[model samples]
Target: MNALSIRSIHGRQIFDSRGMPTVEAEIVLHNGVRASASVPSGASTGRFEACELRDNLAEYHGKGVSSAVNHINTPIQEALVGESCDDQWTLDNKLMVLDGTQNKSKIGANAILAVSLACAKAAAKAYGLELFRYLGGLQANTLPIPMMNILNGGAHAGNNLEIQEFMIVPVGAHSFTEAMKMGTEIYASLRNCLKKKGLSTGIGDEGGYAPDLNGDEEALSLLMEAIQLAGYQPNYDVKIALDAAANEWYKNGHYIFPKLQKKITQSELKGYWEELCQKYPIYSIEDPFAEEDFPGFSELTASLGGSVQIVGDDLFVTNPDRLRQGISSLSGNAVLIKPNQIGTLTETLSTIRLAKEHGYGVILSHRSGETEDTTIADLSVAVNAGQIKTGAPARSERVCKYNRLLKIESLISGSEYPKK
Candidate 1:
């Protein structure tokens, strides 16, 4: 097959739940195949809202978005204008060379993510397989791993800040439908459990009260509660995890540091988390502290590493040098992986391998600003990363990935991929 041609490029708003402009890119291949990808705006109007990296990217959005549009439409487009769509990697690398030094910029990275996703999606369509199947292969299919969320249980919105979010997924369901049914049942049960404890519906932004209702903890809680009510145990077949987003913890000198420190003690903090683990069976915690607090993270990891995984999101930023430092210093035992963090899929995967080599569990995650594209789901399975943390299972943008996984499960009934 000759190189594939790119026909068109455009951007569209996909998610606006939190009021930010998160957008997705649509790219059409020469063969009339359409593919898309989203870049979450990392900007934050509030402390507890979505990841701020997108906001950082926002500063460069115009340039980044334009460059990405051109990257897929320019050199690569020319190289593959009339060629077959096979050999995507070679064409992708050729495009990389055209990008040259500009690739180092955030805009460059955005361009790469958009282009790579479009290419991958095109390839998946060509094979008549789900993107994950193309990326992870049939042999790697396992039970649909369980998932939970952390939306409340923090100091935000008058909540305790003592409890973290979590979810439980059954591992051996026969099909996606069965797994979803189990998830739904678990969510219902959890709702009842919370109601028995006098908790409200826990549906809206005000229901679960984390320090930042708009924060990662709140999102995580919502997901966890949803999973629990569906009739699954948190952290059992359904692995429990949090997306702290580095908001609860702050830099030592941040203006609010003193006030934040006074609200929760180290021992009290440990006790709170310990109790959460005891009651909910949590398996992972991400960005438990401020990004700069490597010592604090190391302490937390060393203290709880035996029973639970400590993950780094802001801590690593998808930089290998930082990851090396993290592993060497024992700052944390896991890393949240995001392609846009470092710009290229290859670079992102390299970080995953490095984390794995160091015994760190890798979690493929989504930004608060997300799109319909679900490439990360496939990336997680392809790399054999243990988990994926998007958001509450309620949102279409978030659940779309889960639903797609279910579709894939339907096609290959007996694959090893986790069922529930």
Candidate 2:
């Protein structure tokens, strides 16, 4: 038997950061090497994202993953137990073929993704290489600049603000460690500012503060003040990024802000974004339009693509086909790569490659519902993704990634931090 051949496969249900059940898969190689991976869930998922199967039973409020866990422990394990885990593409394709579904709804993307990532982790161990080095090869030495989300709204928080995430980008940091220091200071400063205003300093799902601000403008203003309070120069030392998640508020062919009692057309929304970009040190705007509004994305990209990174999260969902469409239509200047969004590491890497081939910036991101899995942290470095949108410096689920990256920085020699 090949030493790299899978000897046993196991699956179990695990609770994520959101207290929701998710699939976790463990792969044991014949050589006695073993690794396990867990899948994360998203609260505000895109319509086009791969299916995350769940039991509709009353258990766990219909967020149970028993069905997905069963698929992994049974049929998926049966097919992959004797297979070699040396080649990620082959193993991942076997999973895709076994399910034989377009969107992985049959076996659940959660199950397939867990097993797929576990296989990769086991293979990396068998080769005696770190996960990042194993996946990215020797040239993968560029550490990504972290886009730490410090404030939350929309579906992610109970705040009145319309934006989903307000992130701080440490643009002037010389290294990944410095970036984390900047992020930590800014995060603390933001908490102080919120408390000073007598606002709720409660944290959201992704570890960002959920304050009831007046609107998006106030949210931006608070972020700016926080940066300044942290002794960072806005736009020079640090910049702002927004995940509008516009799909959350897009209604009846118009965008609505209930807190502001405002409703505006796509064209008007574009003008508003334009004005905000001009007034603020905004470096990136993600999901600026609804997922289905490819035209709106293209128009905004054309208007601000040169100076600002108009990223597509829901518009692409890490699907290469959607990214190809965006590329052809000139929809956005960047793509947010989420492994679960595509159900496999190969597909995720392919999407990153595709984005780079077309000159689009790549950002490895975390789901709103996360686990202590630091796979994305290594992945961000492996691919030199240049940017990562893991949440703030709070919460173990979010901080695990940052901690892993910090360790990697200490271990790897000659690792360069990518220019922000």
Candidate 3:
């Protein structure tokens, strides 16, 4: 028997950062090496995302993951035990075939992803290689630029603001550590700015300040003030990014801004975004239109793709097919890669590779309802994705990814931070 062969698999239900139950799986190799991984949940999920199964019982408010845990501990365990853990594609394919569902609805994406990640962790341990090195080979030495979210709105918070997230990107940093310094300083300065204005400094699901400001532009103004107070030059040392999550408020052929009390056509919204980008140091805008509006995304990309990074989160959901369509249509210039969005490490890497092959920028990301899993941090480096969006530096669940990236930077002999 191969020493790297899987010996057994076990799964259990664990609570995520949102105190919601999620699936965690452990894998033991024949050589006695063991590893485990946990899956995250997403609050602003896409319609095309793979299914995350849960029990409908009263426990955990019908969010209990006992059914997913049972699937991992039983059917997946039976199908994967005694199998070779060397080939990730083969193993991931097996999981997909076992489920025999396009969206992983039968066995649950959460459960399949837990086992899939655990196998990778166990294989890396058995081979005495770091997870990034194991998955990406020796060429995996590029640290991603951190896109830190500092302000929040939309579904992520109870605020009336229409935007979902307002992020700061440290494009001028020479290294990942310097990027973290710039991001954290601005975050602190923003907190102080809000406190002085008597606005709530309370954080949202992704640890960004969810202050009830006067309007969406006010949020941008506060961010600019914070950036200047932090002693960083806007558009030079740092830049702004937004996750509009426009699909949340998109009504029949129009975008609704409740705080602004305006219902405007898609073209009007596009013009508004153009005005903001011209007025601010904005470098990236994600999901500027609804998920279904590929034509709108394409038009925006054509207009702003030369300067601004147009990212697709809900539009792609890290799905390769959707990305291919976007690439063909020139929908957006970038993709937001969330592992849970696709439900497996192999599929996630495939999407990253596909996006890069098409000249699209890749931003590996964390879900709003995340866990302590640092797989995405390694994944970003493993693929040299060049950018990451892992929330603010406040919550431990979000900070854990940054901490792991810092550790990875220390371990690499000649790590490089991506150039702007």
For residues 1-420, what per-residue lDDT tens digits would candidate 1 score against the true structure?
Answer: 332455555554344444454445566766667777765544212231222223335544432344444444555456545544445566456545655653344235555566556667776776676766776676556533545342444332244443334434355455556656675565566556555656554542212223333333444455566565665555554656554444544444441323234455454555655666676556677776666667778888888888787888777877677789899889988887877766556567678889989888777876555666678777766776746666556666667777766665566656554322
lDDT of 2 at 416: 95
True-vs-predicted CA distance for residue 152, candidate 3, Å: 1.1
Each prediction's total of clashing residue pairs, residues at least 3 apart in sequence or on different chains, is 53, 0, 0
Report, for every candidate in turn, its global Cα lDDT versus the true structure: 0.58, 0.93, 0.93
C-alpha TM-scores of all predictions:
0.74, 0.99, 0.98
Residue 197 Cα positional deviation in candidate 3, in Å, after optimal superposition: 0.9
**lDDT (Cα, tens digit) per residue for candidate 3, span 86-158:** 7889899999999999999999999999999999999899989999999999999999999998898988899
- Candidate 1 vs 2: which has more lDDT: 2
User: Candidate 1: what lDDT?
Assistant: 0.58
lDDT of 3: 0.93
- Residue 192 CA error for candidate 2 (Å)? 1.2
